[model samples]
Target: MSTTAHSLDRLIDESVFAGRIYLDGEWIEGGGGEIASIEPATGETLAMVGVASAADVARAAEGAARAQREWAATPHPVRAGVLRRAGQLWEQHAEEIMGWNVREVGAIPPLAGFALHVTAAECYEASALPSAPLGQVLSSEEPRISLAEQVPVGVVGVISPFNVPLILGIRAVAPALALGNAVLLKPDPRTVITGGVSMVRIFEEAGLPAGLLQLVPGGAEVGEAMVSDPRVRVIAFTGSTRAGRAVGELAGRHLKRAHLELGGNSAFLVRADADVDQAVNLATWGAFLHQGQICMTVGRHIVHESLFDAYVEKLAAKAESMVVGDPAAGQVHLGPLIDEVQRDRVHTLVQDAVAQGAELRAGGTYEGLFYRPTVLANTPRDAAAYCDEVFGPVASVVSYSTDDEAVELASATDYGLSLGIVSKDALGALDLARRIPTGIVHINDQTVNDEANAPFGGTGSSGTGSRHGGVQANVDAFTETRWITLRREPGQYPL
Candidate 1:
């Protein structure tokens, strides 16, 4: 793998073009025409990547289908090693990876670096799980029959989004491959330069066979086409709720296994015993991390009545202190919100929230892709910002009189992805965790931060309610279980 120019603060095209889809372990033009990619920070044209028609998707599917059997046949350790080794290669090229993430996707420098590190960890974690299926040791009086195995399901289609490009992108590819499933990854059109090409080079460097992993970059057309392909056995997606629904529908048409990490408007709780400092830190992280585009970032909070006013004060203060500018700026808090459309959408929500009686506690400025980090409190329960997902640098706050009210308010949203419960009372927090209608819960901490091995996903509109199973999810799919009987005599049994 070549070292990228390592352009930190500069935009270098590298003679790249839009619609330049990656497929079958090769970079080539799309079967159709070309499409343009742009830098969200400057609105400048990036390049024209090749556009893949449905036919090209079909070809890729056939390729994966043809190649998957042997990969599925690969042993567990070898599969796991690929991920660990990929992590090694990723570390060496971390700067290149981080730079592209910051420049292409508009994440501030520090957060982008963290994203890279987390992605590397995730890759390795996916490799370490029980590569083989967990077995059963049964106890019987006579003829004992015990059987268990995990088998690969075949080719998996991975479609990731721009916000947590690497985090979401590698989730499917790393594990699917570890489990012996060939992968066709469709990264966000904006981030191929970061984990996109760099990743392809990484797997090759780590000794993964050609065609085991492939990258296809373009718009939704190529991705949708791949999802609809019959050869695809598992579909892993991370993006908006709307898109997840669409993918689920398409997969349902074929009875395919669909894994989705979809929309999130997570809840952050500030219990009376919460450490204000820690709570403030995570709230800011949620409000501005990746421009606050994370599905699990705390978008709303139910602060205990006793701490509500003081917590809002601290939260607003933190929001105002953030620096917004070029993503390459080392000390910048949050970068722009991907593009103008998203930034404007955030702006509208802020304005609407204020109009509906939400106190504009902090933030509401914009410069190009950069929307000021904002916080809102006393928001009307019915306002869109309070009820919907604002994929921008914004947070809405409301208060609760008691633990029950906080839990009720938190679960009111249709999205049940993640919930944060802040309380010193261990029993109360555990009780809250069980009562909350979310797939993942953060007790006495922020509701974000799932590592590679952690089974991550959402419930209800938050997602399809399926556990990603992390690294083991796909490897387990690689093998299936069967019952074997050892007879002491003929038909001797305890039954």
Candidate 2:
């Protein structure tokens, strides 16, 4: 029960660290083997998590389906109360939650705090959904009362990633559960504690009924099993574009609705009229925060050709000035990538870009998993780092002469997740922002931003439109509409 700073040994109950899975109201070993949950910053095994097998996925799904009837019939205020309590619990246990976030997922304190704040807000926002308007009266040509109503899609399957695990997992889980649908969460195995275990504890303490929300953490096979389960109706998936495609395809094959929040190679456009220093600061944060693993990270810095030199120079200096280390040890601007695989991928992209004639303005190295903030100038369009979603702390800067050219360069990517435009004339920036087809756009700001109630998703390769936030989007995502017609008595005219 150590409550000291950076002390994560007892942040969670000892039982959670014993490698159990939460299923149908109990924490027990699933039908699978064990896997070690490692601390990426120190390469230490945090816990031995018991993996979930295909059998476990089926049992959880079946339990959720059976329990959903009672849950949906529960009073709306009671369901909403559970969500509100979960929000309070998240804040009450902030220290412990943030600690696990740092060690398990490599989030700096601020990033971890952001995850906590957003997830709590998500619970609060979802609370209102239990009582939201779910149906509408409609006119019918026949002598009957006609209505269109929203009903829970029963046993939603949530597939969340490691980056910002808490927020991503809860954004879907909270809303779906609040709306009376049972959930089967399949978090990335690399982040089971923060993403999966912590979630179960929160909702359980909040008084949610057992079997309503199950936590099954494992690899892709587990997710595949959950998706293919007939009891699971909708799939809410957040991950890379490549993986998202597979999930989408599988969900489609199963005849289920899949809400996909995929990857991004988002752009930050700096106009010639913008203040160079201010733009550089925004750019640096956009590309370096959370080691640039965010889906909305400003991967491509489209700078005005006139200010390109100064932008590159200042960005390079900012990158070099940043310190990368274990966040739990001390204050550092950036932390390690999730694991060695990500580290290798990020480093390889940076090196390949440099080898392809891109000028390495700063960085292109790593010490353990802590990759330095990298900046590349004049990166070729074909370079992997420039065109693709590198998912690293690497900035690819390219010069654009006109607004149209900037729009072209920004829209050329397969992703349309997020966009940022900075200029002295705010109206001008807003006008230019409209030209780019991103799901989220920030004027005079950076790319990475999220709010609990905002409609948050991207077009194109980024995701399946806005399916994660807002009352309308969540209702549309987790529930389906049914047309009902009622008659006082049987009235038949046809023979």
lDDT of 1: 0.76
Against the true structure, whose lDDT is highest? 2
How far is 97's C-alpha from truth in model 1 (Å)?
Answer: 0.9
How well is each residue in 400-482 modelled by candidate 2, as lDDT tens digits? 99889998998898899999999999999888888899999999999999999999999999988957889999999999999
lDDT of 1 by residue, 1-495 (tens): 122222343232344333555666666677767655566777766556556667877877787777778777677777778888988877877887777777778877777778878778877777775354456677765655655555566788888888878878777777777767788878776666664666776786687876777666667787778788888888888899999899999889888878888898898888888877788887777656877888988888788888888888998998888888786655777777777778788899889989989999888778777788888989998988888999887888888888788878888889999888777786788787788789898776787776766778789998877666564454543334455666656774498
TM-score of model number 2: 0.97
Off by over 4 Å in 2: 1-11
Error of 1 at 481 (Å): 5.6
